[model samples]
Target: MNVKGLDYTCLTLSIIGAINWGLIGIFRFDLVAFLFGDMSWLSRIIYTLVGLSGLYLISTYGRICQVDDAR
Candidate 1:
């Protein structure tokens, strides 16, 4: 597996999740819910994917940071 590509994907999803959280915190808006309906199956899938991506990033963070620090 190409970890580089997977890392990018995870980072992107995590960023999207973060932005959604920020919107909810500042404006009480839920973009996923707005797009897919509250607690709907599709929205739940999206939420799950975003959460999984965040978890993946957490696992890879230390390695990623070490690589950056080496440069």
Candidate 2:
């Protein structure tokens, strides 16, 4: 199966969230908080979106398996 545009978006957001987590672990820095404000509405929204994107990406495992199996 081919990946959809929504999958691309979710994957991108997940990557961004992962990067933010890495920064927090390594440097106690938060890119989202810095850009949007600490726990502000915008930051919360971004956090929520990133969380949702991570959740959505979980479902992609089956799609990925199908593509790999085809190959």
Candidate 3:
């Protein structure tokens, strides 16, 4: 995928991860763990994907700034 597409995907995943964290923080609950079994293989994979997406998004900072500058 192109940079923009990748960025969008990463951002989406990061947002989902953030929301999950929010839920955990406020309610002491884990949606992924609830849906899947607590720390199941599938849940671990989801956590890993979310973490990787967050790392990928870190690299998009420059592009984000450039876009803002253009506006």
Q: Cα lDDT of all candidates, in order?
A: 0.93, 0.92, 0.91
lDDT of 3 by residue, 1-71 (tens): 99779888888888989999999999999998999889999999999999999998877788779999999
The candidate that wins on TM-score is 2
Candidate 3 residue 17 C-alpha distance from true site, Å? 0.5
Return whichever of 2 and 3 wins on TM-score.
2
Error of 3 at 55 (Å): 0.5
Q: Worst lDDT window (10 residues) for model 3?
A: 55-64
Give one digit per residue, the lDDT tens place, for model 2 in 1-71: 35688898888999999999999999999999999999999999999999999998888888889999999
Q: Give per-residue lDDT, candidate 3, residue 55.
A: 90
Task: Estimate candidate 2's alpha-carbon lDDT, on a 0 to 1 scale.
Answer: 0.92
What's the count of clashing pairs in each model shown? 0, 0, 0
Q: What TM-score, computed on C-alpha atoms, does each candidate reach? A: 0.85, 0.86, 0.85
Score candidate 3 by lDDT: 0.91
Indicate the worst ten consecutive residues by lDDT in candidate 2: 1-10
Residue-wise lDDT of candidate 1 within 16-53, one digit each (tens)?
Answer: 99999999999999999999999999999989999999
